[model samples]
Target: MNSFFARRYVITGIFITLAFVLLARLFYIQIIDDRYMLFAKNNVVRTQIQYPARGVILDRNGKLLVDNQPVYDVMVTPKAVKPFDTVEFCKLLDIDKPTFDKYFDKAEKYSPSQRSIFQGQLDSTINAKLGERIAEFPGFELVLRSVRSYPDSIAGQFLGYIGQANDATIAKSNGYYHPGDYVGISGVEKSYETELRGQRGVQNILVDSRGREKGRFANGMYDTAAVAGERLKSSLDSRIQKLGEQLMRNKVGSIVAIEPSTGEILCFVSSPTYNPNLMVGREHGNNYMDLLRSPNNPLLVRPIQARYPPGSSFKPLSALIALQEGVITPQTTYNCPGYYVAGNRRVPCFHNERHGTVNLASAVAESCNGYFDMVFERLINRTGPKNTDTSFTSWRTNVAKFGLGAKLDLDLPGETGGLLPKASLYDKWYGRGGWRSSTVISLGIGQGELEATPLQLANIEATIANHGFFYKPHLIKAIGEKQVVKAEFTQKNYVGIEPQYFEPVIDGMQAVVDRGTAVGSRIPGIVMCGKTGTAQIRHQDNSVFVAFAPRDNPKIAIAVVVEGGGQGARWAAPIASFIVEKYLRDSITRRPSGIEPGYFMNASVLPQPAKPKPAPVKAKPDSTAKPAQAALTAGKHKKKKQPVVYAAAILKGDDDE
Candidate 1:
């Protein structure tokens, strides 16, 4: 009897221990870890993501620039797919059998049960056809989405575009983004993506065994509504922007204009510009490839990306520095007998003209290379040959105060901080002791390796227009409806030059438009102060100009560059004049003899493609064929760039302009 009681107790104890173990596991699964419960819920619940509509962009004048258009995306759940008539489904989707198979396979690979995008950005016609027959296809559904649309179709590169998110984007989002979502790729679209993309929400609905949607899960307790993105009011003036584009129709450079008081970008144009409409809807990929393959590089944002030597346009800054450093005064005179001779090296003046005696104002008005060269020598060699490096560093630092040799931290992406050489760089090239002011004299004339973008040049002019300070240049002026300006753009940036030092420089600039090299392109009544530059390129010179109007309390500051466009007054000066007139006077009155706006609009400076020669024909030449026509054809074929015509009488004795 004792042995039987012992066996029963031991069996009961073993059973009790087994019961506790099972209870603990059940408790853990129910309360501690909810993965199993989530798994169970996934079998019956369907979660659909609700994407918010992107914000609209407007000009400062309340004109629409970028708006949204409705589109549809076809989503599929591979596991829930019930094979139907493949031919009929393909016909409805406007796709072939092979394409259908490919999309299906891609979807299955991503997730068997989770929804994935099959085809996106379908137009209204496809959306209608597919929507009506969507019920017949068990797993496929249509989801509404929005894509960008440009009404005016300007600023293609500035507004940028959105594209499907890649793996890198997804990994960086930290669960915010999944596959098939879109992200801004560049420009203001990229710079303010977070404010433009908005918040995404989700909806939970009950589902049956075959994945058909039932009523809301738990009376919509788990659902959330999406919030639309904040609207952006950009500082772009549509009128100025449109006119700027028209003026630069056939050019291969950029024009950047800014409001000096506010630093707001009034208008910026990068030539060879394309219609922003090409970046939207079904043909985006093909159109992108076409633009990418263009030889003219219509996609390149030249305002902040293309860097070139500032040339004679850099003289004013050099003059200002010389005055501040006490190396020269406004009355300081330098004699230019065609060339500046330092040891055996001779730096020729503009056209090697003998401007016998010139003060600071006269030197700038005439763009006398020898005058600036001598000024640079004085500034750099101030402390003597033994301390040239120290003086050079001081000059470079002061120049940087004008926002040169560094990136401006522009609101757009892909800005290159233009090349500014340090003392170390010269040390690397010509040892420590070998280089001096005379050795790098080219820098004094704004040649050598120094470079600046058109945007930077525009900013330099704006700084001068404001006397000694400028605001950071920007596009967007307000966020949402609050009309709040960014704090960073409001702060004034001083170039460290005293306000009084800019007077003589302004006087010289006025003389340039009044009776100097740029006289041929001057405005009638406006007190426009300006300077011109002809930067040397490999084949031809790049025309450059910088200017501001009225001389006091200036409204607009501008910079223009025309690649292979000859003298600065030839192409760039007239363009700047036209832009200024449009902004201040609201009309362009004068079409000067050589700098006609109509001529620039119609002329083509782009290089023509090489064509195959026709079979040589030995026929009697017809007398009716004009020599002018024949010459034109030959010139087009033989030369890489077209030669510009000049009225020698009107622009007599003009040098760099």
Candidate 2:
């Protein structure tokens, strides 16, 4: 009996211990560990992301260049979807049956419980219509989003476009972006993406099983408000930008204009350009494909991407370097017999005039290849009998000070530093000691291996305008209202050459517009210092011109390049002059042949449709004709032949040297 009682006591102890352990676990789950409670709450609570409106981009004058337009996206949760009128839904969305099927399949593949975009970028009108009847649709919901809209469809490449972010972008966004988020693809939009894409907020709300919000989860206590992106005031002048585009409408080239004192970009134009609006909305993919296939490559940002020899335009920099090195002076003279002869190779000057004895200023005005060639040889061979690598390196360094052979680090992307051949390149081409100044005399005239982008060329002109110092070239003038530009842009960048060396070179450039090759392009009442370059290429010579206007206290500096456009004076020079006139004088005074000044002044981003041919003077119908009969006769008349849409003409030839 005693043994039985002990066993009963042991059994009772075990029961009590199990009971305590169960109670402890229950207490830990209900109070100590809140994870399970939160998990239960998550089933009833829904979190929604609030996307902020992107910033507005404006020209310097506060003209709206890019703004946000309210667009709606039809979102779907596949699991919540129920069978409904497929035909009616397709009709409302204005999509075909096949398109609806495609979107539905894509969303189902993405997720069954999570929301995904079904139809995105619907205009306000369609969105309003859809919202009125949205209650009938079970699984779909309307989500508000903003898409870019342009007031003026100019500066396509400069302004860029926004597109839906890909998986890679989302992965790198650190949880900031989702698959459907829009991001800038290129241009200023891409360069300033961080500043332009504002902070996103979130709202947690109580929801029923049907996914309809009941109310804020915690009376809005956990909700975060979205912040709008900062506004960007660009340095672009819309008027000048329009003019540049008009001038380059039918050509393949680029134009870059800047304010020399501030490094503010006035206008950036790439030829064969399309309207920025073409890349907006749902049709972007199709339009982008068309642009990609274009033979003229309208999408190329030529000002910073395309590189070419500067041709005669490089003479001013060469002269400045020569002066700084004490190899040449304003009075230093060189005799030219039409060409400079070095052993078996002869570099000929375009001008046949003997130019018996030419000084620095005269040589620049005449673009005397022979004179610059001689000066370059003297500068390189100055160190006794051997042309040391150090001399070439120093020469290249001076050239770099002008923003050559290195990227200018402009605010835009895809900039190239341009090609500045090194001594090692020569050593590889010819044995180290075998190559000398005579072997690369072509470089003195801005040919051979020397290459420069249009932006670099323009900055060189601006540097000259600033008298040996320049600010970094930039497109943005200010950020938000109170914020100024970055300190780096404001800081002065000085070339190695001294300020005094610019006077003679400036005088030479003045002569170029006053009476030289580019005399025809000079603006009236403006002291424009300019240089014309005909860069030799595989095709037609690329016409190039670089200039800064009002030689004293210059304001506007510009560079223009027309691929395969023969002489700089004939094409690029005139365009630069027009840009200067429009910027400073606010109107063009001189119009090139066959082009009216008003054509540029009143240019539109979209081509103006040709007016219908005047109706033929048909014999008047009988006065008794009925109104319906007359309308029928008018409609029956064959429509006038539609005017041919003009495309950018592709010119082919070799570059002039």
What TM-score would every model get versus the actual structure? 0.92, 0.88
Write the residue-wise lDDT of candidate 1 on 240-301 in tens digits: 89888888888788999999999999888998899988988888999999999987798899
Output the lDDT of residue 145, model 1.
88
Clashing residue pairs, candidate 1? none
Each candidate: what lDDT? 0.83, 0.81
Backbone atom clashes (below 3 Å) for every candidate: 0, 10
- lDDT, residue 193, candidate 2: 96
Off by over 4 Å in 2: 1-35, 591-656
Off by over 4 Å in 1: 591-596, 607-653
Q: Could you tell me how far off, in angstroms, the CA of residue 288 lies in candidate 1 after the best superposition?
A: 0.5
Please give, for residues 336-449, the per-residue lDDT of candidate 2 as tens digits.
877776534455666335566889998888788878888888878889437557788888889988899999999988888899999898778556776667666777889778
